[model samples]
Target: MNKMAKILLVALLAVVVASCGGRKKLQENPGVSAEIGDTTSGIDPEIQAYMDANGIVDSGRYNLSDPLSNKTIYFEYDSSALDPESDMIVQFHAQHLASTGGSVVLEGHADERGTREYNLALGERRGQTVQAVMSALGASNSDVVSYGEEKPVSAELWQNRRVELLY
Candidate 1:
């Protein structure tokens, strides 16, 4: 064979050998499957503890429309601080993301009382706060976006100030 052909053949052989080793390891670990269908597996202890404490069950999947599943976290007017209930909701989402290796987009919105610029910044802060909590809980793939006063959920001012978790 020519020199180029020989080099290509050697590279292909190496890749095949590496792939076979990975397959062997998966086969040996009967408890671990190739697909991540179990939310309890491969989770950080801290995250698991938080889930247990909050009584948040990981059913291996997330349903946004479920009544128990809280997708929106409302904040107090002009404040980004998360209340106890919001904190719990964030914890649940963080645990799910960490366990499933899924991604989430945190959309922040603010009340229409403030200037557009001010509201946008507040919205961003809210989103970042949620992102920080999720990251601390081992959910690494998260993005934050600020909609500010541009998007309001309801006529009520309280409903406008919120962060929504989108998976």
Candidate 2:
């Protein structure tokens, strides 16, 4: 290879190597940060009631509020429409913003009672419902997102049904 090309290749390699080693030339990346609290240990009271009504326990639940789950807001049956209840849920999240500087993800979920794609759409709507509330409450829209997953509504996986507020 020519001298100029060789030098450029070396520079590229060095940049890659530096990035692998955590070099800060390109801004060492800003600060950083799940689904639910550890249900295997126990569950929060409100979450427990949510689980009980749905015939699931928080134990071993993925998205259920176990200890430190970001929190979630569930929509009415087959509906993504927001309500007064969702308002209170977003308020707590607003407080969370004051303590931590981080982006948030909203996961939308639906009970496995419909087609996978349809359920997924319903789930996304569920997440969007909450995301709207958060954005309305002053949270940045760019930092929030939701995925529609056909998660069961048992305390076991019900945690997955509600919008997952992740950081």
- TM per candidate: 0.61, 0.49
Worst 10 residues of 1 by lDDT: 59-68
Clashing pairs for model 1 are: none
Instruction: Report how far off residue 81 is in candidate 2 (Å).
Output: 2.1
Top-scoring candidate (lDDT): 1
Tell me the tens digit of each residue's lDDT in model 2 across 1-167. Answer: 35674355335433333332321211123232121222244444544543344355333323333222335666555677754334334534543442243457777776655567887788777766666655644555424344555445465444446776765
Per-residue lDDT for 41-107 in model 1, tens only? Answer: 3533443444455455654333322211456888888899976446655765675567568898999
Residue 85 in candidate 2, Cα distance off native in Å: 2.2
Provide backbone clash counts, one per model.
0, 2
Q: Write down the TM-score for model 2.
A: 0.49
The CA lDDT of each predicted structure is: 0.67, 0.49
